[model samples]
Target chain A: SQQGEEDPQALSIQEGENATMNCSYKTSINNLQWYRQNSGRGLVHLILIRSNEREKHSGRLRVTLDTSKKSSSLLITASRAADTASYFCATGINFNKFYFGSGTKLNVKP
Target chain B: EPEVTQTPSHQVTQMGQEVILRCVPISNHLYFYWYRQILGQKVEFLVSFYNNEISEKSEIFDDQFSVERPDGSNFTLKIRSTKLEDSAMYFCASSSDLEPQHFGDGTRLSIL
Candidate 1:
């Protein structure tokens, strides 16, 4: 299906802790992106990792891609209560169309 | 930063009625797309438009669904006779040449 599937459908953690989420896909992709959606809000793009790039970082967010395994992971360091949201990974094969995952609902307790 | 904008945040319509969702993509973007997310489900791609024509579409974008760039800045998605199952959050996105897509806030469609 080329859709990315996120592991650990739900995760609960305390503030100031690090939270990690994983995504796996079935086919080759050109890029993978991560997005966060707050309750009843629009999706906010977090990061993007190309197939050739192994890792990328943006402030508190770290993303890694492994083409051999067709998997990717996102790590949020020092998470705050505001970080609580649904995280989704989308795989783009043609740079135009993307297939999204079911998402991992994250709950960061204060 | 430029952002995609959508109008009519929420719409309520009767089953079998027609609905049109409007979006103003980033001015410089060359690609526009439509997506929908059913309550508690993953986001699904509906169609992609470039050069005033559909570049690609998913199985969900049947004959009843259509897209048009009626003007230079406006992109619209029209659903003819929306079914109850068509209720969902419709999102509009735009991007420029391989860049990350910028998404609008989305329109919530309710078919009763």
Candidate 2:
């Protein structure tokens, strides 16, 4: 019954700026994952941070987790037009299934 | 470079009709899953399949729902009688070696 809720339901910024999105969950999790969806398309996995990992980096994407707060944050630096999409955070429990948040719609205007 | 593949990228079915969504997970993956996302809503897990059986399923996966991996390479989600509320994007995903999932493009089901 645990659900993840993302902060900033919508974000609009000029290209080249940094976009930050935060997610908070209701219960403990084995890992948290970030995904991006372009309009009505399927989700594309962006990054995953385990409970024990405080932070992770992949290219221009950075994810940090605070299990104590049951929260996670995703930072995308040097954003581009292609990066415009909805970002969702998913909490993974023991079942290997995940619960997703409402998501943050990021629009990077060129 | 293998990925989950879902067929009939889009489908429109009448309400109360049966619809089966098909997905072919990664060739070597053992775990499979089905998820649905309504327009402008969060993704909801429908079920997870492992070892030819359902490992877990969400409440939304009620009596009308069933999953099968009848063949070695295909996994399916069947809705006995789809409702108008069933309109959503159904995604299939697979994980190998217990790693993160790789998702398919998804099948958009629009119940009329």
Most lDDT-accurate candidate: 1
List ranges where model 1 is wrong by over 4 Å. Answer: none
lDDT of 1 by residue, A1-110 (tens): 99999988999999999999999999999999999998777788999899889999999999999999999999999999999999999999887799999999999999
**Chain B structural similarity (TM-score) per candidate:** 0.99, 0.97
- Tens digits of per-residue lDDT for model 2 on B23-101? 9999999999999988878899999989988889999999999999989999999998889999999999999754788
> What DockQ was computed for model 2?
0.75
CA lDDT of B20 in candidate 1?
Answer: 95
Q: Write the per-residue lDDT of candidate 2 for residues A41-104, one digit (tens) a residue.
A: 8889999888889999999999999999999999999999999999999898764689999999
TM-score of chain A of each: 0.98, 0.97
Interface RMSD of 2: 1.2
